[model samples]
Target: MACPLKNPLFFLLFMFLPFPTTAQTYRNISLGSSFNALQDNNSSLLSPSGEFAFGFREIAKDGFLLAIWFDKIPNQTIVWSANGDNLVPKGSKVELTIDGEFMLNGKRIRNTEFVGIGVAYASMLDTGNFVLANRNSSIVWESFSYPTDTILPSQTLNQNGILYARYTATNYSTGRFLLSLQPDGNLVLATTRFPQITPNYVYWSVKNPNIGFRFIFNESGFMYVTSKNESLLSTISSNTVSMQDFYQRATLEYDGVFRHYVYPKSTSSSAQRWPKDWSTSSSPFVPPNICTSFMESTGGGACGLNSFCTIEDQGPTCQCPNGYSFIDPEDERRGCKQNFAPQSCGETSKEETDVFQFQELNNANCWGGDYALFEGVPED
Candidate 1:
């Protein structure tokens, strides 16, 4: 027998129960709450719109990247990451403890500048910013202040802000290129010495008379460098993509090209044909010709050593010459090695050198390559 206690007060009490919004799917994480790797249910915290997520993504079989990614997209495009250089193994945990201490595997996050008195809660906002707030509902720490390779709408980078590109598209470790908003008010794109933090050459830069103080990406999809008073000093990307209908992000891609991309929330728009996948917007490529502009004598050429670089519609492509092959086909950026054996210098006389022919590659020349010019040549 079921005993039903249906009273007038009980009927009224149901009116105020909280319900989820149509698009908003996430909830605030209270203090002392946590999630760990390998557990799908407790692992990720999604944004209010369910469009962005922050959690442990398994980058490898036993390796996980504590990162933020686009949740609704099929590609699961990663935007920002914490441990790109050092991937933590499975079972690692992140918690905002009961004592208001935020920690990852019981260790404080590096480079975090905490503000306010005490943290009470954490929330993943629809704008793609994860924030920690105190009892008074004031933000104490936020992910926007510490970005990785990508920046979403409404994010600002103060002077000295930097975006380091990943090694290869698949390999997420620090790579060959970086975009730096220098402390002295210069925004430059430069190549880095491999395996080192030293900047090698400036391939592109914004030269302005008035000093620039900050870099801003507004919600309307416009990017700009502003003065100390927040006046627009120069426009970096002026293209506009509405935030209401599209998910947007600008990234310093592994290929060393800084570009903006847009993902439609629904099917193709009436105004234009949008691809189901992410597509580049109205803004042009930062350094238009990578194969041509990336000729630095100090380091490997645009692609890598002993490799030829070609420009494709999507991006740059690297290929090995006739005699050379990629050292690591899995990673084309590792350069190339000769597949054929070299002739012994002692055995090969000046007359024997005639047997060896130089393969002429049409319209291709190696920049910064050592060469010896001959006065006269016989047509053989």
Candidate 2:
């Protein structure tokens, strides 16, 4: 009934956050004890909270440029792009000067203006957005606008215009993913090569105004949507859970899937209310494996769909479920094997030993197993 992601206490918590310290003199940027604002070199930097920082980075193969990152949170998510396409060359000299602009290895360039409105110095607000401000204290840029993979509540996914591009899968150099609002109000993700409408990949949607907006991602990697208005939360039909509300947050997952989630701010911590209660009408879809977690590779390195891999879990240990199975016992990237075995029911005897117990598990496909029930024994 209550909103979970919007922490009312966030305002007081950010007031005492540590500031960043660096050689470059900043007019408005604050430094923290444990951050490097600029990543490539230590000369420029920010703190850990993703509040404020600056540094040089190389984009593509040809350009080297000075960059800034929010150092306020543990994720240190980069919300802005100073020079997305334009980059400076690697190994070439450039230094961010004290007045606000960086000098190309001490050589002043024509474009010397460094400050923008709405951008702030590592100030975490009640909203999760970390804003960076200029000397006048106006937000020039924010972490919410140029999102890498995740989006927050109150953030609009525009359909009329091309809002985002897929940076490289791992390199972040810009891949082919496009996230935009559709003319019909549904949000979509498509490759530049494929422009046709595809239903399998539609990320999120907004059906009506009555549903209050809340999308949240959990620590376990599940995203959910919920209504913020208490009244609407009760009246909303069960089928609307899968329906994307007007206010929704989606992630352009690394595995090339656009997963939409409800954005709800916690009233206490940075956590959000999640595992969205799905709609009764709309069909719920399962998220891709990549969105669920990150896979670590051994000496063999980065495996593809064809490579075989195994995941160790508490329940089944290593066996894949009903719909899928193991490819190679030794490899994980070759992907999974499909189980064509048709599902059928076998008659059970009426004896006490034959009365089977029914069990429902979250995210589990319910493989083969035997069940036992007792009159008074407590179930775990």
Candidate 3:
């Protein structure tokens, strides 16, 4: 059976593609192009094939973020974003000026080359890359070089390239976890203190003996690291899906898992080999088990403080311990707070003896380190 996504008109071709296409049919957004954050029907610059879009997205009412997303998808899933921590108001605008400067409301931005030829025009490529080119039509600046939490197919992360998870599923601010390809030629996943770039603890890592250069998610949907000679060093994920028939993205999720996901382009709900939604069919997810694997002694463990972690199908689930309630009900990863006042053992007054009772919790393990170790058993 043929896939519906194989039909170009069903997914790619539009009657009015808007911009003038180049020789390769890729649309080059000319200078003097501007998009107001007010978000109308024609606010974005679309890729030639209509597979991706580059524009401002409304994250909340009256709040917008400059973002790139899958254009044809029903939900328009965002792949990369700028200003997640600092969302702009309705009046903001993104434009390429007449003098060849990429400006976002009077501030120079997304200029990858500091000393090279100035920006002449921008193009949103079918590969989901938003690029700025010289007058000679050579690409000088691109979005692939500055990825957020996700990396699309054909994208490569060089040494020191890092992806920080969003604060939460919906909140795109920087989060507690990060995946980095270190300068020492090692790819590692670690927990980091919020608002701090320093790593708290490394939970997952793969070292290369011959020096790893780039971590690539190729067009075939395989993710791997290669040496300087382009020789295969290590396979991060060997799962191969048809990149032609589906949109692929490997994201370091908010839950601290680097997962590979594919969204089928068929538009038909009845799929034989893939699910109708974003499917994690053959993903070689990192850490394998985060609940038991993560051991960040400095801050909270994988599940935060005053909570115990259990693995769920989605990811690690954090549960507040008895006599403790979560500090924030909306976000469990923020940790829990004590429900009752604390009291030292045998410190109750004579009149309060009946009211004061020890809350005996079985298996009260001292995880995340707060107390000193003893050589012998304590006296009862």
Candidate 4:
């Protein structure tokens, strides 16, 4: 049984009581006070687009890395990495701390002290530069400075020193390989202690892209070329079309593979095709990936341990010359061996000595010998 009153004091008190206010959580890339306060938290990073947010995301089985690209751009083109290979997997208690450090399992990383535990943010600017800045607006790092594989229009491949890596077939570990661009504009790759090019320096390049440019490193570390219009957004031109305007860009793959990609500016109005008029052939076997594999296998048609196999019309070969026979034809890794037997002085009879004339073959797999003289042609 409850007592009822016409003027209810309980109702009045309830109405006047203050309600609890929940804290605001911001994730968009806006340029107002909301953006300022968000950075003040020291735990969020912005994506290149204001529409998409970036910080920490648990994707399938992969770990977390400082990634910035298009959140809604179908494919996540991770342009930069704070930690590319060093990924801490999901389900692990990890957070960007307020002191600009990343913390995992209570282990503090004070070096990243600006951002609080589990906190780091990125923002997109009109200039296309995604920057990692602090609350004071001081930039800690930016995507424009460090390039992974692509070189945008405004970016320059710095006039830096030697850049080379190993040739350990499948492994990324530096092997006996080198791909370096010399100050004289020559780009050469060789299998030696250091990168060295000879007098036949047929390969060299300059930085002269007439318009816009984009480069990428595939999952396999194969570098590719892509083009965009300087004035137009989302207009990707063909690698071949851009070369017509006397513009050239060279990319070296992680495997020390060199590719001369050309683009012509006049063909920008139409749909662009990759490599344009340029194509890859095995004849001269300019493709390092193809030639290198052949050389490694010593001409064996089959692939070798931790190595890719290929066939080529020129360059190194496993087959022996006509006058030579293989020491072990079954062993492709052993390469070829000459058949000439060294005899003791005056040990062989004069009749045992025989010489067969040889003819030169342009794409000959094995060396036979050189012809002495022409039958009917006059001497030079």
Candidate 5:
């Protein structure tokens, strides 16, 4: 008897049998003239390599931000956000109308020159760029053009571009720090509390005469400032060859530190560690000690108003001056307040006089210059 497996009729029957297909590893969202509701259960646009995803990411309790992040990472590493300041409810949806109008939570989000020209679809590119395109596939708007706190490789930050720090690691709201390419061809990092009354508190700057009008972070973990003619004026690099293969992001952290972080492509949870490759070096020739040099007032510095910063092994630590106690014990950065009563302005009696004395604090320098200029005066 001939084996059934060797029979042509049996082979033909087996070849035609149906098999269960595996689900797709990633999902692609194609948008047209309708609203695409990106809920926790439903839809998202993944990059071709499945490395990055674009969708509504929960930032706070019932609050979500339209963001792009590393999908495979243990904790979502958001690179760019559309509405950092204006977070919408969890059930909010992003709609792209036929007229090229983009809406978030029923409000128009972006106004593009291609409005009324008919936008075909939106896609998330492998480079971490989320784009809206016209019928001819020309770009209308992209997330790379309006970055939040982080800058991915191959992205250019021009004179008009700004990287605004987030409030905290968990809070996606706008923070006190900002990094901008100035019109004078300088890259400056500034802190602002009230823009109406005070100017930006500039703590870090690249003020070279040959500084370029734009800055670019390349795939090899190198950042370059290039002129209009494409000549490289300055370059910042990590000089690590392994960094080129991983996903990298440079972020202006909320604490006013600009750092470069690298994520391995194939990392197990046991071996996973966010490796900081490079950073905009702080002044005073110490790593992250620049916070001590910045003026502390009602608006500026890492330790907040009336607090002095000191470098600790764990990082910067804020403390109050002598004779003063922290206004908020829970938050030392809120600064300190006088615990004793001030001397009366018009106390003339010698017995009832209040004397003022100075106490020296060791290893402490005032945030701003310590101005002690005084005209001589003798009281009876």
Candidate 6:
């Protein structure tokens, strides 16, 4: 026995009233107004084509580097990293704040402020460029402009650009090798042990004096220096357009080598596989030879202090000098130490008279220079 007015017109009006709606959520991607937390399993941003992804990549048990890499690759070929030298903890996150600030692990990354308006979204492009953009689609920041150790195709590296090598294959800490495009228009590969004490020794260089202000790695795997007007100045690679269909990267290797590697688009049991070396800057033009070119300031060769460096069919090899043994038997790079003392500090003349013969080692070098030569007898 309800009223007719409540059942008729009133009920019709209530049915037409708008209802509250929830905003759609995204997985493996974040909108401009949102954040991507690393604790979430799907925090990574995938490219539109799903070929690449941008996220915190694990370098060690608890160490993580915010990096961009090919998503389809088995081991994930990392191309660019945001914080290579200072890796964040595993649970750190990367977020593009609503006000347009890009924050990594709660710290705002400098120089990412967009002029005029704030960021509309941060996207991972299919070309492997991680970009911060405005609502109008204008780019505010991108990974291509700030490369770490590897440069992808179509990316331009300015004269001031530097590519630093990793400490080791498994360690993401900055290493001793550097590939820099100098202001003088020369691209050089150099190494240093201690920046304050040791001078940077040039291992390789492009001798062209008239080269341009920037270097460009084209999609076809050819790298060329370009003039200010975008004219070609010099070609760094001899590779043709044969690799147009493949993904290519030029890296400054940890062992102080500049090499070009190609990743095939497809993988098969019969296919050669991805990450095959396409070209390398060889000796005579580069180091002359990897083993002898690098003279360790403290040691004889490239190995380390108190180690003998020799060339083998495989590559350079290191060994302990006479009367010495490896500090770390598993790692030759740690160098060597004396296995026995020549004689006790305070011993009888008879004990001192115990004969000690010289054990000569070929190509032996030590830190601070070879053993000092004595022209006169000892004074006691």
Per-residue C-alpha lDDT of model 1 across residues 349-368, encoded as one tens digit per residue: 66667667777666565666
Report lDDT per candidate. Answer: 0.72, 0.36, 0.73, 0.33, 0.61, 0.61
Score candidate 1 by TM-score against the native: 0.85
Q: How close to the true structure is residue 330 of candidate 5, measured as C-alpha lDDT?
A: 58
Instruction: Summarize candidate 4's per-residue lDDT along 138-244 as a digit string, tens digits.
Output: 66655555543323333333323233332222222233334433344333344332123122112233332432243332222124333333232121122322222
Give per-residue lDDT, candidate 2, residue 252: 57
Model 6, span 1-380: residue lDDT tens: 00001111111000011111221222222343333334332446567777777776767666777888877767778888878778777557666655667778667664564442566666678778887777778887888887777888778789878888776666666776777778888877876543221226676777557555888887776788777788877778757533435666787766565667665664443234334433232211234345555543333345555666555433356677668887877556556778886675364656665566667544433334542222233353
| Candidate 1: stretches off by over 4 Å | 1-27, 39-42, 113-117, 344-348, 369-380
What tens-digit string does per-residue lDDT give for candidate 3 at 56-156?
A: 78877778888889888788888998788888888687777666667777777744437134667788888999888887888787889888899999999
lDDT (C-alpha) at residue 343 in model 4? 41
Candidate 5 residue-wise lDDT at 154: 82
The C-alpha local distance difference test score for the whole of candidate 2 amounts to 0.36
Model 4 residue runs over 4 Å out of place are 1-66, 69-73, 92-97, 101-129, 134-140, 159-255, 258-380
Local error of candidate 3 at residue 370 (angstroms): 4.1
Candidate 3: 10-residue stretch with minimal lDDT: 1-10
Query: Per-prediction count of colliding residue pairs?
Result: 0, 81, 0, 41, 0, 1
Give the C-alpha lDDT of model 5: 0.61
* Candidate 3 residue spans exceeding 4 A from truth: 1-26, 39-42, 110-116, 267-271, 346-366, 370-380
User: What's the TM for model 4?
Assistant: 0.37
Q: How big is the positional error of residue 292 in model 4, measured in Å on the Cα after superposition?
A: 6.3
Off by over 4 Å in 2: 1-27, 30-40, 47-54, 58-80, 84-86, 91-136, 152-167, 194-250, 259-380
